[model samples]
Target chain A: MSIASILFAALFYLAAITLAGGLAYRIADYARTPAPLKIPTTPAPTTTGGVVFRMAREVFLFESLFKSNLWIWLFSILFHFGLALVLLRHLRYFTEPVWSWVVLLQPFGTYAAFPMVIGLAGLWARRFLVERIRYISTPSDHLMLALLLAIGLSGLSMKWLVHTDVVALKTFFLGLMRFDVEPLPASGLLYLHLGLVATLMLIFPFSKLLHAPGVFFSPSRNQVDNPREKRHLAPWAAEMEK
Target chain B: MAAEITAPAYRVIPIVPALKPDAMEGVKPFVASEKIQDALGFPGTLPDDWHERAIAKMGELLKKYRSLKVYLDACVHCGACTDKCHYFIGTQDPKNMPVARQDLLRSVYRRYFTLPGKLFPKLVGARDLTKEVLDEWYSYYHQCSECRRCSVFCPYGIDTAEITMAARDILDAVGYGQKYSNEIIGKVHTIGNNLGLPGPALENTMEGLEEDVKEDTGIDVRFPIDVQGAEVLLITPSADFFAEPHIDSLIGYAKVFHAAGVSWTLSSMSSEAANFGLFIGNYEQMRKVALRIRQAALDLGVKRIIVGECGHAWRVAYSFWNTLAGIGAGADDPYALMLQKQLDQRHKQPTHICEYTWDLIQRDALKFDKTKNDHLVITFHDSCNVARASRMGDEPGGQFDIPRNIIRAVANNFVDMDENTIREKTFCCGGGGGLLTDDLLDLRVKGALPRMEALQAVVDSHGVNYLAAICAICKTQFSKTLPYYGFNMRMIGGVHQLVSNAIILENKQ
Candidate 1:
């Protein structure tokens, strides 16, 4: 294996472990911490089944964002949906036979990068243009946008602008999965794209990106509006009664 | 109401105001006195190690409350909630924006807790919990009404109210508690209400109310106090016994009970339903304040506990009362189960007065002469807590509908304010979440600009003369701020006040 392959392989392992383990630890922390009060934003669903539907709508549709601002919602859905397709399409690199759906989704996923880049641009522009959004934006916020934009551009460049040996890249990724390092494509754009993706994975658990899993645990969104019917007592609060 | 503090002019289109950086700098609520702090079990004064203590308190809260932890972590600063805050829109202060306000604490939270913030503080907008930062937290967090309006629009459900509450809790933990909330909480602990009216004083107020009602309507409507074995226990805000328009709603509750023919009594032990502990965001203190209501229900042997018209009071009674004091059902705890068993299961435990009145109106049990309110074309102001934090009837969004229903039944001519200013999207009356104190008068008047603009629109288009509300704070806030906007202070009154004006007392007729 080449030094480039070995370095890339090690970095990917570290990134994957950090992403999964960090998310697990953070998610468990959120799950264990009790929501001492019933704080569902009202007009909320009362039943458990209703709460499930509400959360589904929130996650799948960004329902609150849609209700808030059409501009943010449009860009958010575009980037998120585009990223979803691209990630799913990339499954062809890992699977031995390249799943039938992944094979079929290749064309659509190639086009998805456009919307993904466009969405990120709109979101980043808001950070500079909108006074309220700009006031709240920190260096990390702007940098996060820059990083995502770079990843998207580099990935697109490799795909269309500067074509790399994709068959070798796929073999290198599949080898990494099986702990058998292989030679990587000699492409600067490919390395940059992979490196950025690794960085994003590493930071996912620590940054506001935790919002991905945090939404699932948000008491305001996840909780049922049945405080009158059922009592919710945290362990610490319950000790007060004892 | 201050001479120098000018109210913002009403907008023809109700546009969100432009950012005015530091527009409200140095605008902080009064610091709690040592005695008031001690009354709420906080330190008598700012401790020497306040910075460390505040950080410690934030860490403790992060572990205890999921809302605090998740909210602190989840905010993406999307600015969806930027134009959403009434204070931000009214004051034009970027710091009043929900995201900016939350960052006052989030910055410290990051510096102390998160890895990126510890490693690259400026990059992530994290800072040390310095005296300056704490002072900033104090100024901005109090400006928030804890209304949860921004939470409605957040993509991740990042509630600024939860963050503000957590920030206040940390502030109080380090002897930085606001005077208005801390003092009122102290009053609730000692005198059983925000007004600090003693039992005899409350009795006198009720007696005076009874005499006035009898003289006005030629009917003897008894405002019974501490009556044992009453079927219903009415726990209302002490403002009802003191403040104008609020007292009218107090009489309205009595009139509703008399018309419904229910045996109800007010308990001196828990005469107040407004829980300032909630305002201060101290869970233990909140629970302690709620426990009095439970004790009163048990002591008076009342089967039902119905709340009076107060915004945060109704929120606590409806949402937190069960968890805090066992005022609702399905509790595994013995005390909670005991209280639950004693409360009449047929009706909602600790119901809102509007809910009770609306149920009666629905059943045709109460008669209203709508013509009595013909002189007034009225609009309803959905109190922040009632609009976004609590429910009324069994149906969702019932809190908004129930009050309007009561108004429509009592008054023939009723028009709603702008749709955006009503229901779940309602703006706060500016003097809520313990900012109702006189010290915050300037912030209160200015923060009410959005609501005043919406009201002005209806007044111009629909000739709305009266602004009806269910929450005591809304009535009080609007009554004080209405005159500043070229309207009569008397134009604002409670939903129940309308019921009082038009309600037909069978005994009188």
Candidate 2:
């Protein structure tokens, strides 16, 4: 294997571990922290089933954002859904004899890159165009958007602009999954795409991207509105009783 | 100061105003004095090591409350909640925006707590917690009403109220507490109520109310206090005993109990339902204040505990009372189980007065003379805390529907304000979350802009002559700010007051 293959292999391993282990630690932190009171925004679900439905609407439908702004909701849905498809399509590399669904999703996911890029552009444009959004945005906000946009554009370039050896690239990724080493494709564009994806995974736990897991733990969205029926006692709060 | 302030014009639709940076920078509530701080178990004054204390407090809170840690990290600055704040609409201040208001604390939280902020503070907009940043937290956090309107719109449910509460909690820990909330909390701790109304004085006010009701309706509606062995214990804000429209609601509660023939009494121990401890965001203090109700419940041996019309009060009672004081069921703790067994469980452990009245109205237990309120064309202003924070009855959105149901039953003409400004999207009374002090009157007048504009639309189209609210703070805030916008302060009244106007007594001559 070339030095580049060895370096990329090590980088991917580190990124993967960071993504998995970091998320595990952060998620454990959230779960362990006690929500002392039931503070679901009113008109919230009374039952566990109802709360599941509420969360489903919020997660899948962007229910609250849809209520807030049409433009933001449209762009957010485009970016998130398109990214989901693209990520799913990328799964073909890891599975030998790729799943039938992955085979079916190949064409649609390739096209999804356009909407993903367009959505990121619209969201990034608002950071400059909208005054309130501009005021609240930091350098990191702009960079996060730029990073995603760069990743999408580079990934697309490999397919349409500068074609790379997909079979060899898949072998390299599949090799990374196991202990065996394989030669990486010499395309800088492929390296750029992989590098950005690795960066996103590395930062996922520490950054605002924690919202992915944070939403599931949010008391206002996830809690059942049954404070009157059940007593929610935190360990620390309960300790005060003794 | 009053002469210098001008209320925003009434717009048909509340247009998000142009950003005015630092417009409300000078507005800050008076700092709590040593006596008040000590009474509430906070530092007597701003400690010498306040910066360290504040940071330590934030760390402590992050572990204690999931809402704080999640919210501080979850915000991606989507700007969904930017125009959602009434203070932003009213003052046109960028800092008043919910996301920006949260960043006042979140920026500091990021700086000290997170790795990226420590490595590259400028990139993430994190800043060291300086005196200037602390001052900003004091000014802007007080401006928020803790209404949770922004939370209704946030994709992640990033409640600025939770952040505000945490910021205020940290502020108190460093001995930099706001006078209004801290003093009120002190009063609740020492005097058993926010107003410090003595038991004898409360009895005097009740006697005056009884006489007035007798004169008007020729019925002896009793306002009993400290009566043990009653079927229900009524815990209401002290404002009900002293303030207009609020006092009228007091009379209304009395008439309802009189007509229903349910035995009820108020307790001096927990005379105040409005918990300022909630405003300061101190769990210990909030729980301390709430324990009075449990003590009252035990002493009075009341079968039911029903709270009167006060928004945050009802929220504390409805949402947090069970957790804080064990007023609700499904607990194994000795204290919670003890109170749970003592109180009647057939009804909601602590029911809102609106829920109580609506249940009676639905069962055809209460009679009403709708014509009594026919003279006034009415619209209900859903109090922010009650609308967004608490629920009533068994169904969801019961808080919104129950009050409107009671209004339609009592009043012949009823109209609602703009759909955007009512229900879960309700605007603050501009004076909620301890911003009602005289020092913050300018901020109050400015923050009332969106709500006042919404009321103006109804008045223009539906000829709304009276704006009824179900919160003591909303009633009091509107009564003060209405005249500034060329509306009569008398236009502000309570839902129960409307019920009082129309409620017919069986024994009245």
Candidate 3:
């Protein structure tokens, strides 16, 4: 019933609204835009099933980037999969009587922070170390890396050094998920972690984080290499026919 | 030996040119003259409200193309594709890096459209639409050949070709069109080809080709022109009518038609297959040039349309022609529907000449004496457009293999260049996408470095004396730039040029 707890709860709701609504609008805008040509990068799949498989390799494996540079690929895949595992771990905070699988993943997800932080550090180094990468890095690019690094390091600090009231933290997150409001923990560590998470959510809709959803809508990856087999005409382009 | 044109002692292609930071600085093509710009229906010069109009055009295109919009947003600047561009590798100008080139437009796009750009432009590397920004667009966008080599390496498949095209389209909208492509497109409209050969000149050139073939092999291979009711209408580059290595490929096509007994005629109306409309990224101009092919096809009453060895033209014909001018199937309207009903469904409506010749070699319908090409050790330079943008012979990698298969079938000694440098990962010939003009000759010479390095490796080991290509631009580029790399210029030619060297012209049993 503390004022800080109530304010934090309201902030979470606002963050959730912005993340969901902004992403929805951005995605709708992307879907509404017409891809006027079939421009799948070559040696690409010819069938719908093959395209799905190809996309799976790209999303899961970063196949093209793997072919490009081994150094970047290793760091990228490690960071992404580690983040995915850690996200699964965070699900325990919102679910009551956490699922048995979530209980099982607790230790492995805790250890995933190593790759997550190390991977981010490696990528950050390339922003300064690699000549080509250094030349192209904007201020926002380094800022994005620093932000992610802060989140990862702070979360690890809570796990290793500062022990917060985890039971109350779960209660607070679960209350936010449900309509019932509960008091948040009074630990500064807890406040810092929740604050950074909320900031990422707020920026998610506007930032380069759109790459996550934007990759799926990329015409080059999504389109089948069948321009010769099928005549793909956008609606506006089809108007030209008449 | 065709002719001795030895390479210079100084190496224009020295191990990928050592990445000099500003090796190709301030290199830009001449601006399109007002007359040429007006011919393509673009503004003759920059109007007073050019900035607003350019931004408005970018906004329209962003809404119209998901590729452009998504590519603009999706690039993470991970630099995965930083070293992939041939121009960047060859010139070492950081701006030539695909991501940097994309960022040129993306910064402007972000500033005007995205929130971060509007609020805090410096942080996001976004800038206002200004004269300097417009100049960078003109310089860097043209530096790109629209080859899509960057897309092959991008993790998200962010095609810089798509971005380059969109940028070029925006530039053209604001009256900053390049002279090379716009002027060539104007000529194609007026005189039926890029060379501006009138009907009389075209007819006379074909006559001269027929006589030359008779003297060479005692074969009366007819180079028919605008013949009514020919079985196939050959849409080749006008350069094939006059240029050295290109003209040889023309004779090869003529000989193939004669040997196969398939009647094919060159169109006086749509004689050129190199559509500069695609080069300038003008959809209407591309469509207008493409419509000539369809019109000629209808008038001549050809059953099939076989495209000549041109890179972007095949991309247009295979990909956009169906959508643009109804040259292929899947059209609903009367214009496309009529052609669909009239043209032969047995063959691809717009088939590649390589696919045509390969089918003959596959069917054993054509005969080649391998010993005839024993003097040459051949290798194939996969044309960028055919390898990446288009397909051949109904399979996914048919574009890569069919040409190689044809080369192996014709030549006694055939070896592929470095494996990574061939196929879908092929480099541009440096002269593609309207860079073939003299103004960008430095870029043309420099961009040939990676490809020349790959060719030199083969020459040092396997002695690949002939670098056969399928694109007219590739042939012209290598012919010009090869001598600078200490290789003979005549060593570069079309894949069919090899076929012409080895094919027995006599009626074979």
Against the native chain B, each candidate's TM-score is 0.98, 0.98, 0.96
- The digit string of per-residue lDDT tens for model 3 on B1-509 reads 11332222324544322345655566789999899899888999999999999999999998889999999998889989998888887678999999999999999988999999999999999998899889888988889998988898889999998888888999999899999989888999998999899989999988998888888898788999989999999999888999979999988888899899998899888898988888877677888898999899989999999988888888888878887877887666776788887889888878999999999998998988988889999888999998888889877899999988998999879898887889988889888888898777778877887888889889999988989988889988888898888789999888778888888877433
lDDT of 2 by residue, B1-509 (tens): 34587787665456678898988886898999999888877898887899999999999999999999999989999999999998998888999999999998999989999999999999999999889888889888989989899999999999899999999999889988898888888888888898988888988988888888889988888999999899999999999999997999988998999989999999987899999888888889989999999999999999999999999999999999999989987888787988899888888889889999999999999999999999999999999888888899888999999999999999999999989889999889899988888888998998898888888889999899999998889888999999999999999999999999999897732
Weakest 10 consecutive residues of candidate 3 chain B by summed lDDT: B1-10
**Residue B319 CA displacement from its true place in model 3, Å:** 1.4
Top model number, lDDT: 2
lDDT of each residue in A113-232, candidate 3, tens digit only: 889999999999999988889989999999988988888988999999998888998898888887778999898877888888899999888888999999899998998877655677
Query: Cα RMSDs of all predictions?
Result: 1.3, 1.2, 3.0
**lDDT score of residue B211 within candidate 2:** 85
- Scored by lDDT, model 1 comes in at 0.90
TM-score of chain A of each: 0.98, 0.99, 0.97
Off by over 4 Å in 3: B1-23, B507-509
Better of 2 and 3 by lDDT: 2
Q: Model 2 clash pairs?
A: none
